[model samples]
Target chain A: MSDEKRYLKLHLIVLALVVIAELIGTKSYKLGPGTIVLLPMLYALLLGLLTGPKFLKIIDKEDMNAAEGLITVSVMLLMAKYGTNIGPTLPLIIKSGPALILQEFGNLGTVLLGMPFALLLGLRREAIGATFSIAREPNLAIISDMYGLDSPEGRGVMGVYVAGTVFGSIFFGLFAGFAATALPLHPYALAMASGVGSASMMSAAVGALVEIFPNMAEEITALGAASNLATGADGVYMSIFMALPMCEWLYRKLIRDRAEEVIKG
Target chain B: MKLSLKDPVVITVIVAILTLVGNFVGYKIDPITAFPGMLILFLIVIVGMWITKIMPGNLPAVVYVSLLGIILTMPWFPLGEKVAELTSQVNFLALTTPILGYAGISLGKDLDSFKKNGLRIVVVAIFVFVGTYLGSAVIAHTVLKLTGQI
Candidate 1:
């Protein structure tokens, strides 16, 4: 196939991957094989390869740059949904809310575990951007240009994002499992926790959690739906808050000075 | 095996159908139950893979499958009429959770290589996540509370 055809094909494949992930993760199958980790990663890797060369070229395109807008819409919608959903049960959800936020904090508390893994897992960072980009819109060309995923830093962070995605799932999944063992909490809490990053992964996490602990299955579904809406609503503002400083620090500490030296040459 | 997966059009057609079909079937099934929704999702994915001649891999794929299974299925599985009622009352979470996660992590992942400079970036992520969580939670709670909804 020609390059554009190939590119189009890749984009389509990525979309398919999303669909497949959505299907299997949303289902009730147990021990039938298939999990969340493989599908999306492969899709992302394929996306990266397809768009690697056009990364810079994509940046030059004008109307195609919808990164900011898309992210904003996605985040707001997610948060609004979450907030509105819990609006009725505010008292209970709030009583439980601190714990919910704390649970997230505890997961992040593992920054000790996460940092080293991130340092080594080169693809996670870019994958973070890529995954978000895809969620914003499946336009590979636009994502490539906006994030410059071809950059050394971009590549490095993609590694971190992928690793984070995997780790985040397992960590949260296991947390849910253990929590279920000890507490009166429900699986929705777990799914909500997992959905903290990628919806696809969160969907998978909720599916698995419900299957193993069939008792809490209902709670899990409610949480998953709630999680999606919550994240979608506040996601953009959160992104700006988190990404700006982190990217700045990474660029200054990792990418900038090196590029500066190259420029001087 | 690899050749089938490498085919882009095949992958796209397969996914689009699965997504539409899954959503359609998912809608048909009562989101209050788990089995039917889960089954439909599983069928779509496994069949999609089979038709595309691809197999599941380690880690990420496994997680994806497991997660998808739970998410799609739980909605349809009979979790008691309570779950059904509760979920319907709170379906807005569907949109918020995913959006926050996608954007938050997109930004969060940028933290990689940032640690090479020491604890500064990690500190930033901590503050950001905590601050945002609190900020959002406080605003959310206040709004709900003021409306006498809380």
Candidate 2:
């Protein structure tokens, strides 16, 4: 068989398996809302791991890239739907602008809080770039381009990027669900909390929120999407202009044994 | 004509069809009702992709599609109500499943890379997750308090 044919066959097989797994996992399992929300994702991850390099020959690098590309369509649709939902609530969403700004600060807070640990852990100065940024796909690209992927900073960023890509959704979903139920915060506030730039993580967090608050699902989703968009557009610039410098400054002040010089982007 | 899985055009078409079919089946919407919204979605995706190409920097396609969706469905626009009515029923949860599935699989494929980063990466990831979540939550809490939205 031609390579194309083989690739197509593998793609179809994996997709079929995934759909089946999702159906079975969701239907049969009587787990809690959080478990239910995460079931399909876990199933897919398990299937991929079983068929991945160390095990079988079902999926390869090329197939993975193709599958990743296909997800762009899903993301676009998800975001577009979010946009439509936000339409009716545009005025209210706008009025809640302070919350959105706060959300961005919170996103920045992650780097601020994470940087100290990264430096204390003896992570080189370059690692600060990756650790300080949001560590989404675009940030990964920017870091990789600025600091070669083989550099300590690149490794640090890629490590966070990979971890975020794999586990970010699950964490976000569970965290949002837990926060919504456990905390005194409003569901809409929790909803806005879901949008930390990564689309998949946002979806998972919103999904969990929907399970918890079905009536407010639309609002939660809209607010989450809007927050996500803001993070994506503004977060990048913020990371470059503000977050990176702040992290470097913190490292210099706090870390006594800082050897490597900070690479200004 | 031969279809190549590697061809982006072919991949896009396949994905579009699968998503449409998935939406209809998963959401159990009537084909007639779902068709218009699906068409609009497709147009939005295509246009979003084009916009991403021309736009400077790495502005995500989702941004454009969402922006466009917001604009088209805004109350001021003539077709806003109609478009909103048609697309409102498009259940996003059903749409997120397959995408998350793909993401899971892709993560598995990159397991080696993840392993290479070692356990310290896990620590960094934890901090990253905690910092972002807490930071955002604190801010959201304060704002909600000030605005009396909570």
Candidate 3:
């Protein structure tokens, strides 16, 4: 009856609708594991787009923010669940240290492999900061502090950060699922691959693995969670001490030729 | 009657209820078992959030919750096995459905920003994924081969 209550009711209704849409989308399709991994996300995005700015007209801003804030709870629950799953496998995870280390290398590889293309695309120097860093929530803070948020490098990183936040999970989920099923690699390796720091991406990646290898889901989830935790803890230092400088060097090398071309023209 | 959804207390209560309902419906576990499992999860998250808030460095809530979960459910800890058994029925994958759904909606809000970044951003993201996947894969492959895991 009260305004607050009314707004809350409307928000719940909208959320129910979104969830129903996702359910229908997922249930109606008989897509492969990769597509199924992404179906809910795709449906949510499509519903959000279709509903668009108009939904804003109905839902109050504060209430909308509140709804978004609830996402943290979901993430926390998912992490807790993941952590519980990892408990029994603690010994195994410790023994798999080499694989975990390799996963970190792979995480660093994103910057190594992404920067050249970023530079070739004429992203400018600042983007190197963004491209080189893993671009998760923590790295964003480190980058912002080291090179003020307004700096081009800051903006570049922010762009990728946003892109990663938005698409990272979807991409990782689809890729991990596809890789686990199609590649010759071990599922555990793919599981380690899932822990690229961002929780959503990790969840999506691990979820895809579950769909593909149901029997190995528990081990896979546990390994992925461990790898992700390691990335989060060690990744901060790696980004600051190693990735930033490495990316900068690669960016200059890649961009210098383009700069010379511009001068000659 | 005048409870604001923005209130943390309100949100917490709502989340606890939703998580319970979600576990029940999705996992199809009996209420007695499900309630305790959900309660443990809820407490873990709350404590994890508190720890993150008080911790010196910028520890993410995910890390805290995960660490807490691991510790509480460790084989050495009292009630570890029991909690693990109950929590395992919580249906983590079911929980992921709504989380990913919310992530999608959140992504939708950023479509314009993404569009502004151009196709280049997509290329960079792809490379980010490739670098991560390949970097991990190459190392993992070597390690597994050496250890005879494959």
Give the best candidate by DockQ.
Answer: 2
Largest TM-score belongs to which candidate?
2
Evaluate residue A120 in candidate 2 and report its C-alpha lDDT on the 0 to 100 scale. Answer: 66
Off by over 4 Å in 1: A1-113, A120-146, A160-175, A178-191, A208-216, A250-265, B1-150
* Residue ranges of candidate 2 with Cα displaced over 4 Å: A1-3, A25-36, A60-75, A97-100, A115-257, A261-265, B1-5, B24-26, B30-33, B56-60, B116-122, B137-150
> Per-residue alpha-carbon lDDT of model 2 for B1-150, expressed as tens digits?
776676645555555555555556556666577778767766776787788889998755656766787788878889989988888656555555555555555555556655754676777777887788777877887888888876
The CA lDDT of each predicted structure is 0.36, 0.66, 0.65
For model 3 chain A, where is the 10-residue window of minimal lDDT?
A28-37
TM-score for each predicted model, relative to the true structure: 0.37, 0.64, 0.63
Model 1 deviation from native, Cα RMSD in Å: 14.9
Candidate 3, superposed: residue stretches over 4 Å from native: A1-11, A18-36, A39-42, A54-57, A60-70, A97-100, A115-265, B1-4, B24-33, B97-109, B141-150
Q: Report fnat in order of the candidates.
A: 0.04, 0.55, 0.52
> Candidate 3: which pairs clash?
A106-B135, A106-B136, A126-A153, A130-A157
Residue-by-residue lDDT tens digits, candidate 2, A1-265: 5667755665575466456554654432223432223444345546655665567767776666555554544455656666676565565555648778767877777667787777666566545755676576546444544453445665577577656755677677778888888888778777777788877778878889899899887888988888876675556557666776777777777664343334331
Q: Write the per-residue lDDT of candidate 3 for residues A133-246, one digit (tens) a residue.
A: 557655654554456444566556656765675566667777887787688888888888888876677888888989888999898998888888777656666776678778
Error of 3 at A186 (Å): 11
Count of clashes, each model: 98, 2, 4
lDDT (Cα, tens digit) per residue for candidate 1, span A65-183: 22212232232222222322333433333444443443332222223232333333333343234222112221221233345433433433333344444343443344445544564
